[model samples]
Target: MPSFTRRSLVALLAAGSLGLAACSGTPSATPATPAATASDGALKVGIAQIVNHPSLNDLRDGFKEGMAAAGYVEGSDVVYEERNAAGDQTTLTAIASSYATKDLVVAIATPTAQAMIQALPDTPIFFAGVTDPVGAQLVLSLEDPGGNVTGTSDFPPVADQLALIKEILPEAKTIGLLYSSAETNSHIHADLVKEAAPALGLSVQEATVSNSSEVAQAAESLADVDAFFIGTDNTFVSAIESVVQVAEARQIPLVVSDPDSVARGALAAYAVDYRAQGVQTGTMAAAMLTSGGKAGDIPVERAKDLELSVNPGAAQRMGVTLPQAVLDRAEHTIG
Candidate 1:
């Protein structure tokens, strides 16, 4: 149920859906003014995301949990209008446009955040999944956003992840950097790896993809690389299974920036808990809306609950055996 995407998620499994679930709210089309609520005075919260994937799905769930923790229980004081663009740019714009009139919008990814900001300059937006928010220009600054946008940042701990890759694949030299070129955060992650790799005695070979369809080809192109490291690019993570298939077929060690990919069949990750990130974003959003704090006035948060996760089975499938020390270091492990 959590794996399905978008409007389909609602029709088929809204009762048990994950990312974009149960969106039922009514608000005036007057766009972004405060005090906007549903017909019954419930907060009209819009849940928008670019696509449906494990981490993003957890993000959506975590947001609701966070909001509840902040005393805005769903179906009680707050109501929602959830929308997933399903990776379609046109649909993303439509979702953002619709969210413009809501009291608040929680954008689950960078692309969705960008669309929401563009469509409703005055709307309150709390985002999760953006690695480089400042570079994406969703906010003026993390400390002082200077506008109607502020939320949590899921910047990958690239250096740590790279070091983990090196530890897991000691003889590895050139590492493949696979990501969606369209994601600015992916670029930022790649650059971070390139910048930090040499110090750890590793080189990078990049394979930039424009969309999910290109993932397999991009990965196959980097077949000669000793190992592959993919970051938090929504497009790339959304299509992680393709990369996993290629890795197992070629026996190339695969490391990813997303911890959830471990369950989907990646070796390991040093990642900020994305669900925790959503909680952070939702808490921030609730504070702003409830306490009358301006979006700009709230400081943008950087995710800090980092966890090291590993899949022993994935490593075996990728033709590598993890050392006991590696397993000991992991905060979580999958079969």
Candidate 2:
């Protein structure tokens, strides 16, 4: 896969952040100590999750680990309130609003982030695994967030995945992009594919779904395309099994933005670990809580370790065998 030009990468970053910014509030200065009272030994933290899924579960677990590492214990030093919206925007807003009294709120996924941005601009908010924080309008810039929100980004280098797809399917010419029309993260990947695909002699066909209910139909719409490229689309992700059924039935290879999706059925994926991204965000949150760093003062960080995951079952089902070179490079393989 070819590399993204500095300019294009910047553009993608910008778009992702702006989209997140749809929910915004005033920026605050970094705090001087842990947000919680040390003597009381309790920090009230609220977590608003847009949906209940395995990936989000990884984030929650990572967050707990990060907080524990920072000396916050579950039953003693910290109090946590968790809410899952199940992908309903109304429920998301309600969950975010309910957390207004907490010392801090951690919003997972773009929708939850957006809701928190709107409902609690004054309360410090940390985000994790978000694709484009700036483009989503959640913050101003990665270096100087310019708002009371900052965390870790799960924004993988899409260009590299595009290159990998071509390598896996040398004869592939038309790549189908299946994602949610409503998600800012999906659009970020779309723009990236548009920018990188032409250079590889591939054209992209887009199929949009607004919710999980429509994923099957949307994926089937790409039947003519040679292969499918999976973005970090929440809608599509929530229905991974269905998406795999449609793609595999058509004998179309699938590539995903996150490695875990590969284990579920995608042929191969070039991605960063979602739990690692959560841990990154959690580390920053812990720093802010323990070291007096301001949420708005710190820049959002990107995933440092990328992974390649392959599913032998998916490949076998599709009648495609990945060469040893590809398999050797994989960090994990699921059959």
Candidate 3:
């Protein structure tokens, strides 16, 4: 098998110019084609994603990189038919059903995974960016999936995230939870925050949005809270700038579960590296394809590394101060 490094993948993404398109379920005109082909036969892989956010885009790139590392050359030995749902549930189901006959289908988020599970019961499915597989009922267990589905889970580092919030805002009493109620992962994170906050001497306030348009209003509704916590909820993350605007206007410190969001203006985050999660899922999918293994035989994987990201300028704008110790511990500190 060949080895593809992160540097190589970054170069590939840069050269490809992958950007978010208008909300649509159609495949991009420029699908990621592998430069090399396998000597034996090409493998057809279907990648269905929930939306075109940066984190999901990075996950898609990482999946391709992992396939390359496994000696599955795109265009040559492998071909990827990529589809994005653009945050539309109808599109998600349609995309999943379309990939029902693929050699292997990889779903990037929880909704896509659920759609694939329903649409392709016999087909192998690899899911990434899912927070709670069991809770979503996509699998029976993490250790033993017991079905034709397995992949990586982007379970937020809820405890760590709350700890970071406490470190930065010691006087914080009530932490507001901002997320979409329709997302199972959002519910999981909300429950986690509610369960974890009390021990940290903080209370939890809830604000839910059914869609992205309501995100700002929802955040504003929780103005009584001392701080805001945004989970890896796709709906909320896709419209994070709205939440950021609300946070800045209200001077409420915003903490997120995705490191990429920190770069977008959230104060800080101790979250999973989504690209790494994609690589892990893609590698597993490659192994299954190469060996003709069943998804049921493989156990679901969880993110092993968490990155700490802090933005001091965002902190100052939100009326929070990041102590020197917290700044020193951060793996990424944005300006």
Candidate 4:
């Protein structure tokens, strides 16, 4: 498949620190250690993504924005070669191998990061949107990367998101979970749902798939459940329309982990902003490259701002009625 890309002409870094608010997800990071290196030439940056889902796309675009803010002028101070694996493991591996000679590489999600680390063990690599870097073994620890890899993690507050499901469907007893079996990110969220569901008096019914082609059937298999919950699984999010179709047909209220999918027809979401995460990761990348720092020198950060987004029209389509309280509490509401 052809590579997915955009001309990333992001801005210079803002003058002040972009602080993350205290939250209970991944721990906030300590600032990257800096050591300046004098250079007048542009840096080459390679971005690798597992697929072209909007969340990952947002992360990519945001990374460029962060880099731009860091004072790297696109095509002048910096140049980018972005590649998307289109959900193929072989293509992802090939794409990772191709970035061996670039100044640095940004892997957009867990799978892409894993592939890149495997392909270029000695290269500077930063990952964005990875949910559990520790679980994936991408880093020895978030505070101390201990290797040539470090970046941002997008571990949404799954327990809080599960609570939102119960808030919307007070009498609902079971929520169906659809995710990819191969993704560590998906597994982490699935475990979270299982861990949190009982607290909300809800049981989880899960449907797993290995690829996008199996998505619709997987959604169909969970029709018996009262509601649907989606995570940041790249495969499922890439084929989100199938999940939406099934959810609407069955009139199952759906809650998700990010705003983009809410626009795609899921009823609501509570998630860390993808673009913000990109900027966070981008700044780290800039710090590492400009300061002659290794990836391990920077602390891995999680999203600071978590947004509650709701779409009443989507709720109606999925046969859900949102309480006015939920709508009023939303930071963003999709029409």
Tens-place lDDT digits, model 1, residues 1-335? 01223343243222221122111111112222233343587888898887778898888889988999999967758887777776777777887887767888888877788788889888788888887677666766677776888888887777889889888988988999997766666666777789999999999999886777788899999989989999887877878898999999999989988889999999998898988988888888888877897897887888869998999999999999998998998999998
lDDT of 4 by residue, 1-335 (tens): 11111221011112112111111121222222222343446687888887777888899999999999999878778878877767777677778787888789999988888889989988889999988777666776677776789999888798889888888988999999998877877877787789888988999899988777888899999978999888978878877888899999999887888689988888999998998999998998988878888897787888777999998998989888999899999999897
* Model 1: lDDT to the true structure: 0.79
Tens digits of per-residue lDDT for model 3, 207-326 = 887777788889989989999999888878888888999999999999998888888999988988888878888899888887888998898888777888899999999987899999
The 10-residue segment of model 3 with minimum total lDDT is 16-25
Task: Give candidate 4's total backbone clashes.
Answer: 6
What number of clashing residue pairs does each candidate have, in the order they appear? 0, 26, 4, 6
lDDT of each: 0.79, 0.77, 0.80, 0.80
Displacement of residue 328 (Cα, Å) in model 4 is 0.4
The weakest ten consecutive residues by lDDT in model 4 span: 4-13
Pairs with steric clashes in candidate 1: none
RMSD of 3: 9.4
Off by over 4 Å in 4: 1-40
* Candidate 4 lDDT (Cα, 0 to 1): 0.80
What are the root-mean-square deviations of the candidates from the true structure over C-alphas? 10.3, 6.6, 9.4, 11.7
